[model samples]
Target: MRSNHSASRVVWTLTLCTSLALLGDSTLYAVLPSYHPAVGIGVVQVGWLLSMNRLVRPPLNMLSGWLSQRLGPRTPYIVGLSIGALSTIGYSLCRGFWPLLAMRALWGVAWALLAVSAYGLMLDVTVESTRGRLAGIYTSISYFGGALGAMGGGFLVDALGFSPAMFILGALSIGASLLALTLPRTQHLPARHVAPGVSLAWRPRLQAWAHALRRLDARLWLVLALSFAHRFLFAGVFYSTFGLYLQQTLGESLHVGAAVIGVASFTGTVLFLRNVVSVLVGPGLGYLSDVLGERSRVLLLGEVLGVAALACLALADSLWISAAGVLLAAMAYGIVPPMLVSWMGDLTRTGARGTIVGGYQTMGDLGSGVGPLVAYALAAAWGLSAVYGLGAALCALTVPLILLVRSRAAGRAPLAVADHGAHGA
Candidate 1:
């Protein structure tokens, strides 16, 4: 029991570290587009600068996973946080395309390290009983960091200028790095022998990932597909286009039966409220899964909500109705992430956990990275409403996948899949 308490404390501490490391990244998003001139860049450069981090993450995530497997989570986690701190500081010091571009790529490296290590650490300290709840806790706290950074960083820049605000954020990131020192220097790895076809190199090989893929059965495959779809639609397509969607459908200002509200304000509020709902609901949903001893049921609820939300957005004409749809969308996405991640943990063992997480992150990044470009292209051919309807249809498609995974689980000796094909080390 005492060990459980200590482990829980460690999870909480790691969660805080993740939140602090996110400050500069989230702040940059809020600050860059509006203050391009102050940062010594053109409006054209803003999109590239913002996207460079995610564009660089796929390979880095694989590498981060390999590192977590080789060196344990502590060293790499601290290194990532230190790199993030330096990158945050560089944001204040560097200017122009080349220099800031390098910083953004370097931050990408840091995030890859941070994400995988934190995920690996969570797996290290948790059991099947505790995984869902702790995953929720991590998601809730980490999101709070992003929300704080987006809002607080903008406020700081307004009050103290960009350079000072960045410097302060860098200092906070350093503080988070310091906290990581409290974690164990080396975590226990469950398997003594490397899984077949997996390499020991710093850089992940395609064959290695291919081997990992071959090992996952249909259930895990569905989880990975859902991860991609979730990010593609919510993070990539919807967020990038929603503001424009509002402008097109409702005009620059939302008319609430004679009450006037700026579209920009309305968009920001809805998005921020979406984050707020995630922070509030993330843990509760995770806890519910833990109590029920099943994550797919909760995941199903989220998917249904997503379909309903997107359908509402596609058809609704009123402001309040749109807001309701946004809220539903928020709950939908908020529920999926923690539940899915925890579900993955439940279905995999510790030795191969990092690699599995790496694949999940890679898919998510690809989805988000590719989503907007494809969405806009599709929208041009079709329309925003049609694109949204397509998204709803795509979301609904996941329901069958979930039921398939659940049915597969039912056909086995309950733990057979988790213990052997899917969860084996």
Candidate 2:
């Protein structure tokens, strides 16, 4: 067995490596507008390019889980980074929609593989009690990298032009692939086997999937629903269109707008005060949920705060107001993922953890895919402000859904007892 220090180092290294690999994704948004105009595609087509990447996640995530079980997580993780590097290089040469779309799809598959594998490895390495804090650390680093990637790509595109900027992204991805090879080999240990004659056959796969759906434990479902909507709106409206909107509506230079949003988001995520708050206060909230036995309450608090932040953004008349909204939203947004992941860990058995987490991630991607399309449609009909308002409303809906989940879970055990007593009598 590895020492705790060794395990922690491995987890952090993997997290950082994953973050670097994902930097390519951030650069895509920066480079696409420039590339699209050169290739005669409308701005709306860029949204399709973004969403299409997510369209692959649901099925690809399922495949990733099975492959990880069979080949070990590290193997697939390395493979993913390699493929991602190649895809990034290919992206530098693309001139048309079809080539770009194909490269993005390849990148999506690589993302699914690396994400599922790396998360599984992280869970395996860390103690359950420390999972939330570790998750926060992981997410914070990832977002920090994203901010840098976005800003750097924008600057590079402005100075060096699109193809050369893409070449730099490809080079970074290749470096990340090299780093992935150094990850510890613990994942190669064989998983504990199921009993003989017990097979995860097609029928069982379908049955397990059905049971997972039906018994979806209301709390887990609520988290899924909230994450889906939250990410969808954030990605589709805020991430996908915010730069374009600022450029078009506010007449800000694209490079300046992208850099400002990137810097603000980065600064918000890296706040030492926020990290201290998450470390000190997040666990107290988590422990309270454990004691009260109500995960939904914590989730509701986070979502409500998020909705308020979104509303603030919607009403903001200046860049400063938008920056403030992002800071507030980041605090709440930063809290939810770790809390939800910890809750899932608490509710699941060790054997099923990988599959469940993979499913959860896939659903988040699905939401992300839908969000952009919906925002685009709404923007076309009404306006960009309408898109932000709708995001706030969707976030607000999560509050009630969380309460419903809590109620259902609370009643489940008592209802089981009543049924048993009636059968005995």
Question: Residue-wise lDDT of candidate 2 within 1-425, one digit each (tens)?
Answer: 33457556766787777767777777776567666786456788887776666788789887786676556567778888888887878777887778888888998899899888776666555544455656656655665666567767777877887777778888988898888777754333356588999776798778877986897666667666666776786644666666555554446332454464444344324343444443444545555555555555666777777787778767878877766666566666666766776667556543245666677778778877777778788889988777777788888887777776676676554111111111000
Backbone clashes per model, in order?
0, 0
TM-score of each: 0.91, 0.76
Q: Write the per-residue lDDT of candidate 1 for residues 1-425, one digit (tens) a residue.
A: 22557558878999899999999999998889898899889999999999999989999898888777767777788999999999999999987888999999999999999888888777666666777778888977787777777899999999999999999999999999999888864443544577899767755656876776786767678778998999999998898999998889778897778799998878877788888887778778888998898889999999999999999888888877788889898888779988888888777665556767788889999999999999999999999989999999999999998997798778553221232121111
Where model 2 places Cα greater than 4 Å from the true spot, the runs are 1-4, 35-49, 93-96, 157-165, 185-204, 244-298, 317-323, 382-387, 407-425
Query: What is the clash count of model 1?
Result: 0
- For each candidate, the alpha-carbon lDDT, in order, equals 0.84, 0.67
Q: What lDDT score is found at residue 228 in candidate 1?
A: 97
Error of 1 at 64 (Å): 0.7
The top-ranked prediction according to TM-score is: 1
